[model samples]
Target: MAGVVKTGILGLDAMLNGGIPEKNQIVLAGGPGAGKTLLSFEFLYRNAKQGNNSVMFVVEEEAEKVLENAKGAFSGLKDIDDLVKNGSLSVEGLSAVSNASESMRQSSYEFGNFISDIEAIIADKKATRVVIDSTAVLEILVKDPLMFRKSMLALVVDLRRLGVTSILTAEMSSLEKQSLSFRPEFFLFDGIIMLYLSGEEEKRMQSMEIIKMRGSKHSFVTTPYDISPAGFKVFAAEEITQE
Candidate 1:
């Protein structure tokens, strides 16, 4: 059996038949307000609390904003600031690299440099878990779909080589129409977790499903979940009914 890295989200581990396979790259797919960021944050925060070092690469939002939002969203996870300050957790923004490479000048060079920097940080910190908030930013940088797929595959391979379990977030236009036919990342990733927001406006609800998980048996049911002050709470036994 492959080694596992506990997600720390309540009830999620049991659904995964234990936890995510060590060194596997999983994609957290969802639309806006689906709790992708919160879930990923909780994964890292929980791991850090267990004496594991983690690094979060913020691409869609500013690092400071991500940290601030995490504090409010996960009030039950104490000492978040201290954990970051003490180097047990690290949150970094990709804005600098994005801005510097904006002219499309030497795109490959800039991208390679950024990857090198990430690898260096992982090594320096001995981080066991990593999160890349929104791989959508890479779509803007890479332009060509085929090239983006190649780049993404390379990045995942690198993360695996570094021996760190990683979560890469991706935005979907609509959860109802999601299909793996055209998404190369879906094929490359070791697992895919899709988050959903059902109902209308005021009555909206959030849920998640394990679409695919390699090397392990996982619950395929759409499980109801909530983003509370403590972080992600997955109701593994309760299914989200379409009313």
Candidate 2:
């Protein structure tokens, strides 16, 4: 049996019947302002706090901007700077060389130098948890659907082979259209967690649901969640009712 890694988010682990299985590559899917980034950061933060080293690869946003946003969004999360300085948490932005250089950016084959850099970080940091914030940009990188599928599958397989629990964030336009057939990643990952933000103005609410989790039982009901100074607070026991 595979080991489980605690996400450390309040009320979330119980929903997973303990925690996500170790080395499982999961996709965090949601629209804008769905707290995807926050959840990913909190996952790494909590784990690193417990002495588990982690690495975060910022694909869309810069590393410094991510840290600043986290500070503002999760004010209660103190000592983030200290954690980074102490080497408990490492955050890096996608390398420009890997993205721009022809030699590093392969046209038809593989994920080139970008993936190589991530592997290097994992080994150097001895990281057990990894997060790739937003794979939407990656879609742009590959351009071709077939290539994207192949590249992503290879990436997922490589990450799991590294023996680290990984979260790869993806952007979705709507929660109503929940279909795995739309994207190749939905099938490649071992688990899928969907975050949602719906309703109008004042009535708008946030919720999360576990779409699928291989090798472990998980709650299927959509649970409401909040993004406050403390980070993501999931109400797993309370099922969300659309108003």
| TM values, all candidates | 0.90, 0.90
Candidate 2 residue runs with Cα over 4 Å from true position: 96-110, 175-182, 238-243
Deviation (Å) of 45 in candidate 1: 0.3
lDDT of 2 by residue, 47-137 (tens): 9999999988887877889989998998998988889999998787755324433442455424655677678878988999999987887
Q: What is the lDDT of candidate 2?
A: 0.82
Worst 10 residues of 2 by lDDT: 96-105
Error of 1 at 94 (Å): 1.9
TM-score of 1: 0.90
Alpha-carbon RMSD, candidate 1: 3.4
Which lDDT value does model 1 have at 231? 77
